[model samples]
Target: MKLRRRLGIEWTGVALAASLIVCGLIYWNSLSGFDNLLYDRLSEYDRPEAPDDVLIVAIDEDSLATFGQWPWSRSRHAALLNQLADAEPKAIAFDILLSEPGDSEEDMAMANAAAQTDNLLFPLHFVFPGTNGAAFDIKEPIASLKQAAAAIGHVNLLFDRDGVVRRTSLCFKDTANGTSNDEIVWPHLMEQVYRQINGESSAIFRRLGDCQQPLLMPYANRGDFAQVSYAAVANGEIPRAFLKDKTILVGATAQGLGDQHPVPLGDGGTMAGVEIMANLLNDITADRFVMPVSTTMQIALSLIPTWILLIGFWRWRPRTTIFVSVGLVIFILSASAILLSLQIWFAPGAALVGLALVYPVWGWRRLQATSDFMDGELKNYRTETPDIPVLQVPLGPVDLVTEQAEELAHAIKHVRDLRRFITDALTNLPDPMFITDLDGKVKFVNKLAQSGVEDGVQDLALDDMLERFVAPEGLEDVKDYLAIDQELREHDYVDFTSVKDEIFAMRRARILSDEGELRGHIHYLADITEVANAAQEREEVLQLLSHDMRSPQAAILALLDGQDATDENKRIESHARRTLALADNFVGLARIKSSEFSGEEILLSDLVIEANDSLWPLAKQRGIKSTVEDYTEGAFIIGEPSSLYRSFANLIDNAIKYSPDDSDIEIVLRSIDLDKQAFVSVTITDQGNGIAEDMLDQLFERFASNDDDSHGTVKGTGLGLNFVSAVMARHGGSIRAENVREGGARFTVLLPLAPEPEELV
Candidate 1:
């Protein structure tokens, strides 16, 4: 069944089962005397009127008060019977047994009195059930009294577990010295009296059918039955009108006899055994009984409310269903009370109890189901992940289905909230992420994880930990697999190339449980393409700078070979300074666009002078004339001063190297206007074979030079101009390399003029 509807009937079934178990337990306990509560409750119903045909000549407390205690001679009981017979009663039934020839003459007197009175019935004391666990009657009536009676009937009363007399056996098995036929199947004293007076079989016993033959008996009234004192009857004080034609019972109602028992109709004190028999016989004769309602019928009636409750849960609100169930139970109970009032028996506690438990059991079941559903959803998202889990509780027991779903709902809500938080944290992360099982199978992959992977990639496999993708031929695996400086191999990480040549840093971590056992892997893949490229470019630039710096070292060695020691020493000093200047330039170029962005005003002439001073020794070694037309013009910009000096020095040194021996190299500074903004311009002209008209555009590019064909004597390192261009761009300036019409090359530098002192303010 779908959970929603299963929810309705599931708990209802639980209620029915639990209630049945409880009812059955109670029924068993009642068999052990607890059921007296139910029977005692039934006693609250109205009772039948006493059968006027039967009367008790009670041997009461008042009789005991008058007749001097109990155990009065059997001759005294015979006197009562004979006196009762004189009134022409239909039958005189004695509740007392004339057993054991006590005072033989007195016993003979009682027996002789019974023989003379034709309608007197003597008590046959049979064993089974009369006294608990005894097999046979202890003391039956003596031979004389037994022969004198019209019929011998067993007064074997049946008491319920609570010690209350609710019924009497219709027949008795007289396992004693009694004759066969009717004596062998001895009848109840009440039944014998009933047969003698009514002349018909009891209909109440027949009503039980084939059920376990326990008859339900009801009393006619509470307390005293129609009676006269036994002493009164025996002394002839009771009038004949009170006993005439009546079925008089001569039995002990005296307190000293201890023959009293709780009956269905008595108020509190025990009813005398004789009175109990009187009530039974009277009840039988009047055809009044409390027959047990058939189990089939009771079950059917119970289902009425059960179905109502189930239907309400299925179609209506739980509260309404619960109210209906309770109402139906009350109706059944009220109807049972009415039936019992009319002296009938009915019990529907099972159904009432079942419905009572339905609400909570159902609610608890739904709570568990909801928790399981939420857990399942969390483990693997059902329909796309929910923003907030909508977990709610079903109906409950006392809180009824609808009335008290709040508590369970809150419980589910709490768990769902936790699940949502975890899901959001894992799935919505900016970095591409994945979760894999212990077997190395991909269980989950976040959006970024999938998007960052190459087109053919879907999952990560354990076997490919060290070799995720094929390496290109001839690239050192050691350099590519491991970082440049590190020797340790990181097999749990992989760097794969995307179709767009993009690089992703895929790192995997082992997820472990609390006990430190490996659970799975949490892989995070991030796009590191730009970062990787920048690192490669920086490495290449450093290699180039290291190689080019050897040129100044070669020149310093060449100076030591000069003939004059002074000139050689002077040139060596200049070459050493030049080498230092070149090192500073490489450092400045590398540091230009870095985080240090402090700027200040520097004169244009100062930069030119510094560049010329550093390059003058090189010009002298090359037999070249290099001159700087220094101008004190405030030609500067708001930029790093060291980077600016490096840029100007690059242009001057290039001019000096490219010019032939004794060739003129002039450095001129001027001011220009573009877009109404003042800019400082420095021009360096080299008078040599520098007319490379086809390579002017590529001149400032890294590794581009006039020696493209390798035919020129000036071997350019090709990085200095690129460095110069980059440094100029960092200062918001421009560079130009052109063939001067006077048969040489001219390189121009243009920088924006720094604002005046007032403008700074």
Candidate 2:
């Protein structure tokens, strides 16, 4: 379908999606940078190394305090290695870079110990030129340590353009006398290490040339990882027995070691240098990596879902499509969150954004086109045109003159016939019709108007006619409307005074001559008596029914609760009373419909007092406190006395029924003046299970109740509040029900106070 023919909801969804896509594109680089930082940090903290079985023998603060700042004599390292060898660890790694020559004798001892153990792997470093025109080098102790360890590998770090460490280097380059160069990578480290440990090289690292580069690992905060103090390890506080058949990494964590790099790790600081190596080791061992889908694939995936949503919305109504689109968006977001939690990097913002933007625009254009087409078709029918062409006969000279005269006569007759037809149609219409000459003298009056006019006023001037029959206010409006028509050739329609209790609408349109001269005016009067009478009858019926039925129903309920009634009889009587109450509700609805109720000024405080007195017995029987607070004692409002009483009674009854046995139902009356109009407000708040947020909007609608299970249960007719709403509306007031933030539902009735005539003026 064309875009203009799509549903509004589809178009709206598309618009949202487009907006998101635009926003995402605008912030692409920033978002990508943030993602990279987040992943790098998470990976540094949570990457699985050699499992929990691995241990770190730290050279910590306590060790420094006991044995002085690190770079302890190689002989001390020899002793520590020897102690660990007894535990039979699977392998051992040196996170620290030992480069400078230590005591020759101690280095020899440590190297000898390493050779005998055959488990240690030493770290190598990659150096790069710095900004200050100087070369920085990472030195790993090679001379004395070369023959001791099974393998050595570089722990090179790579940072993004923004200087944020995101990727790690797994290889290093070595040149000898400008003659030969060798590249050593993670595969090389693993190959030598496995060969030495297992006594044979495994096929896993055999395809060195074809293997992918360093794996991408999930990142987390630095504190997310487990760390033990170097002091504990050096003092043998760590469970040495558990180190058996495990890998161990020994590294430095002192603050000034220059190993720290800015990463999205713990507390927005860089992860300790040792932690980065540990994570890389974990990535190598466990093979946990992210294989990012290509950019093209990402875009395609995003667009496909959006297109599907748009298609579905196009086939649905605007409102339904909107709901569905919203639901889809929510689902998409939720799914994205879940995927992220599971470490699956799917493009959420891109896909959902596209969907949101495209659908709405598509739907709106579609709906607009459809509406325009329909409107064009409707216009064709509203316009008037003759079905057939008129015939013209020609004649010569004298014959032509006579023929022309005869033709003119016929044309005049046709015009007269048309006028008579119009006049006759006007007379039969429900609206009163009148025609006047340019002098404002009455020329004709339709049947309805003639019947309504006084006996002597068969023909009269417009001004005299108005003065004799129209009210002064209505007369002034008519005169002004006529004056406007005279000056502008267009006049505003004015409402005429009600005739015989019927509302009348009047409008005067100018009748112009063919020469563009003002000829006369056509006055239209419509009798809206039926419409008014129907409204008034509805109100009266509602009031009468509410009043008549309540009396009997209340008496029956009182009899049911009387002391003379036995328990069984009371139960039976209660059921009967409830049935009677339903009937009373029906009657109230009828009275409300008939417009029988009228308003009067009554003190809000007095109304509350009377309501409390009447409902107190029932509330006490249920052991609920029915309290009333009248803060507007002198404040008066206009409403039918009986209608107001019944409305409050219904609210109190509802509160009593819903509230807990010992809970309190609070009733308050107060005066509020807004926009200089006084209103008396009655609030009935109940300590009941509050209405749900979703159901609150429909609370006051007729036959709408939260209680769905009405089988054999006391169910109200649902007309009590409906009647109350009707009564309030009649008195130019309103009632609203809402769930309180704290608890329970509160029903508020706001009634307008009858203003004095002078005040109205």
Best by TM-score: 1
Q: List the global CA lDDT of all models.
A: 0.68, 0.65
* Candidate 2 residue spans exceeding 4 A from truth: 1-30, 33-50, 100-106, 128-141, 157-184, 188-214, 218-240, 256-271, 279-284, 309-317, 331-344, 356-761
Per-residue lDDT tens digits for candidate 2, residues 246-359, read: 767777766655667776454567766666666655544554545444566555655666766666754777788778778777776665445544545444556555666666
Q: What's the lDDT for candidate 1?
A: 0.68
Task: List per-candidate RMSD values in Å.
Answer: 20.3, 35.6
Best by lDDT: 1
Expressed as tens digits, the lDDT of each residue in 1-761 for candidate 1 is 34455565565666567657545744553333433456666665556677676788887787887767577877777777777778899988888876767888888898888888988787877554445555654566788888888877778778776677886667755445466543355667777777777676577645644323556777666654677787777777878887888888888877678888877553666788888888778777776767656656666665666656655655767677667766887887787777777776666566565566665666577677655545544445433445555554454556333433454456457567867777677778877677778776777766665553455234566334223332343123423543332225436456666445667776666687845788877767677888889867886776666556756676766766654668768667656755655565565666665444677877778767887888787789878888878463656767776667777777787677667777888888888899999888888998866646656667667667544332243334366787889878877889887777777778888888899888886
